[model samples]
Target: MKFKALWITETAEGKFERSIIERSIDDLPAGEVLIRVKYSSLNYKDALSATGNKGITKKFPHTPGIDAAGVVELSRSEHFGTGDEVIVTGYDLGMNTSGGYGQFIRVPASWVVKKPEAFTLKECMTIGTAGFTAATALHKMELLGQNPEQGPIVVTGSTGGVGSLAVAILSTAGYEVIAVSGKQNAWEYLQHLGASRMENREWVNDQSGKALLKPQWSGAIDTVGGNTLVTLLKGCKLEGAVACTGLVGSPKLEGTVYPFILNGVSLIGVGSAEMPMSTKLKIWDKLSGQWNCREKMNAIAKEVSLEELKNTYIDTILKGNVMGRIVVNVEA
Candidate 1:
């Protein structure tokens, strides 16, 4: 079948260029199942991969989408059959391998999860990798004894994809959520996601050189790494937990172990990509069931087409200009 896909090509001069081109089933790598991608989502990693970032994607002439949801077009594994709904995210997808920007994807059976009955394909993509990462962090923190009554849970980068979903899901679970963002213009939007309060970006960039500052938050979900992550660690209450995921700020962590030794603060690292399937399933079940924020997520999501992605969001998202989740209708 003829289908459309975004291809990022590294020119002979080592510059990168993008194109939406036609692909066939033969072009997809061999796997046990074939999915007709109904929806995919734009993510920071996708943006990085599109720009010829060797760390995120060592190869070019590649399709970049870390998240995809659709129906099974074919299956060799007993785990899935044609027309079965499925979700594909993470696990080397859109990295060295062909990804979901194309209308169809063939992947290993273990890499594909049966989409929960309650979650539609579009809704799955709406939440995408960002939502999955947020859910994973919270799941780990809950296991570490995090609770709403401890104190307000602060979410840094609260207007970005993972940050926004973290705010909504944490709020839905009854935590008093304090959203921190540099986009002062989007305070109303953060509140709409159920953040009880707002804090400017400056709130998480403390540099007083104190080994441990006064504990303010009981817990935090940190998407912006670097000094902000360091600040959150310093301010967390005794037994407080902070889930660290993105490195939009910086990957290098330069802080004392004082928070852990003195305050009993737990820093949890979250990695959704290449996340074990067992853990991934648990997070997905919650995202599709009780913590299901499809209605709330739909409100924050802006749909875009494959054709619109390269021209519009590829550059903007890299510059941190996105508002909330950007869901891509690959079928469009």
Candidate 2:
């Protein structure tokens, strides 16, 4: 079958070009399930791949979308059958593998999750990888005994995809949220997402030479790494956990081990890209049930056509100007 897809090609002169192109089912890489993707979502990693980031996509021509929600069109695995609604996120998708920017995606059965009845395909794309990451961070934190009663949870980079979802999900799970953002106009948006309060980026960008600072929040979900991560660890309450999910600020983590030793604070790395299927199912269950924040997520999400994604939203997200999730209508 012929289908439309976003195509990225690198020029010999060393620049990347993007276009909408036609593809065939025969062109897809080998996999156990073939899905007719109805919706996908834009993410930082997708932006990187589309712009010729070798670390993301080593090949010249590729499709870049880390999240896809659709119906099975073909299946080689007994675990999934044709017509099953499903989701594909992380793993090697949108990186070394062809991803959801296409109208169809063929992926390993193990990388596919049957869509929860509670979420529609579009709704599944709305949550996408960003929501999954945020929810997983909270899941891990809870597993480590972090709780709402311990104190409010702080979320950094609060206007971005992951941060926005983190704020909404944590609040839905009964925690008071302190959102931190560099954007001056984000307070109202953050408040709408259920943040009890908002703080400037400086609040969590401490530069003090001290090993630890006064305990601020009970725990944190940090999307900005480097000094911001250090600040989160330094200011967390005793036995509190800090879930690290991004490196938007910087990848380097330069801080003393004092927080871990003295306060028993824990730093949890949330690597959703390669997250286990079992854990993915557990997190997705909570997102669609007890942690259902569809109203807030819907409010934060805006749909875009594949054309619009390549022409506009990708660059917008790279510039750090996007306020929330941008769900891609692959069928559009």
Candidate 3:
């Protein structure tokens, strides 16, 4: 059967032109399972790949979407079967393989997880990679001995998908959350997502190159790296930890080791793309049940059809003007 997909073809000038193309299972990359994708979600990495970032995607005429959820149409492994609902994220789905920006996807069964009972296909995509990353960061921080009694936890890029979900989960777990963002218009929205207070992006930026700043936050989930991460490293309380993810700002970190040595601060790097399947399933279960925040998820997600995604990808995400998550209904 043939299905529709948003294909990115390279022009002679090396730019990409997106168009809906008819594709069949034969066109999909070889895999152990074939999934009829119901929904997919956007991420920064997807934006980069769609724009022909060689570091992310080496080949053109590729589909770009990092996360997807749907029912299995065919399977070659005992772990999954036809008609089973499942989700696929990370592990090369959108990088070097045909990804979720289509009505269907073929992926190795090892990369698939049974969809949690708490969420439908749409809801699962609403959470997608962003929510999973947030949950994983929180879990890592807790494992590293972070607790609510310590003090307020700060979340940078609070308006973005990962940061927004981090605020909701932390607050729902009885922790005080301070949401930091550069978007002045999103302060109220962040508060609605359970942030106890809203802070400007400046709070996480130390322009003086201070080796150590006064301890402010008990812990932090930093989605904006670069100067923001440097500031977070310096301001973390004694024995505190910060989960560093995303290089939206800059990949370089120019900071001293005084925070780690003097304050015993630990920086945990979060990579949701290449985690083990067991860990991914565990986090997905938590997000579907105990850590679930329906209100906040709805607040941060804007549902759009696949047709609308062209402009969304080119304008909102590529230009850094997007806020929250954009869930794509592939069959819409």
Candidate 4:
């Protein structure tokens, strides 16, 4: 049967266009499972792909959604059966392969996870890759022995999808969250997400030549790397850990190791794309259960139809004007 999908096609002159196209199951890449996608969420990477960013995607005429939640329509693996609720994120969902922007997706069984009982398929996509990444960063910090008693935990880029969710999750987990963002309008929103305090981007960007600063924060989840990360390193409490995820600011890390050797600060790298399946499952369960912030999650997400995704990508994420997650209802 043919299904509707938002397909990206490239002209011979290299221009890209997005339109609703009809596709069949046979059009999908070979995989052990086929999913009828219920919902998908937009991410920075998806915007990159939609705009022909070679770093995130090498091919045109491709769907560009990195995260999806839906039900199994077909399965070749014994691990999952037809009609089972499931989620698939990362692992080439939107890069070179067809992604969740479509009404259907075929992926390797290993790339699929059973939707946690605490969440519906729509709710799972509401959390999506961004929320999952935030949770993963917090989980790593907790594993490194980070606690609320040490000092306030800072969240940079605090109004974006991952940053906002990180603030909510950390606050819910009993940590005092200090949100840092340049979007002045987001202060109230961040406060609603449970941030104890807010810092303008300028405040966090202030640089001192000193290798280490006052060691103010006990721990942090940094989504904007580069100079912001450097500043964060200088201010981290002794023996504190900071999980670095995105490069929205800059990818280069330029600073002294005094924070590491002298203050014993730890820099943890969080990558959700290639994480082990077992680890993904654990994090998903936590997000669905204890760490789940339905109110905050709902507050940070906007629902849109697949047809609206193109304009949303160009006008919002690509321009960095987005405030929270954009959840796409493929069938809407």
Count of clashing residue pairs in every prediction: 0, 0, 0, 0
- Count of backbone collisions in candidate 4: 0
The 10-residue segment of model 1 with minimum total lDDT is 287-296
Global lDDT of model 1: 0.90
Q: Could you tell me which 10 consecutive residues in candidate 4 have the lowest summed lDDT?
A: 311-320
Model 1 earns a TM-score of 0.98
Sort every candidate by lDDT, greatest first.
2, 1, 3, 4
What is every candidate's alpha-carbon RMSD to the true fold?
0.9, 0.8, 1.1, 1.2
Candidate rank order under TM-score: 2, 1, 3, 4
Give me the displacement of residue 331 in model 2, in angstroms.
Answer: 1.1
lDDT of each: 0.90, 0.93, 0.88, 0.87
| lDDT (Cα, tens digit) per residue for candidate 2, span 213-278 | 999889999998999999999999999999999988899999999999999999999999997788
**Per-prediction TM-score:** 0.98, 0.99, 0.98, 0.97
Give, for candidate 3, the lowest lDDT window spanning 10 residues: 311-320
lDDT of prediction 2: 0.93
Model 2 per-residue lDDT at 47: 96
The residue-by-residue lDDT of candidate 4 on 35-62, one tens digit each, is 9999999888888888778788887788
Worst 10 residues of 2 by lDDT: 273-282
lDDT of 3: 0.88
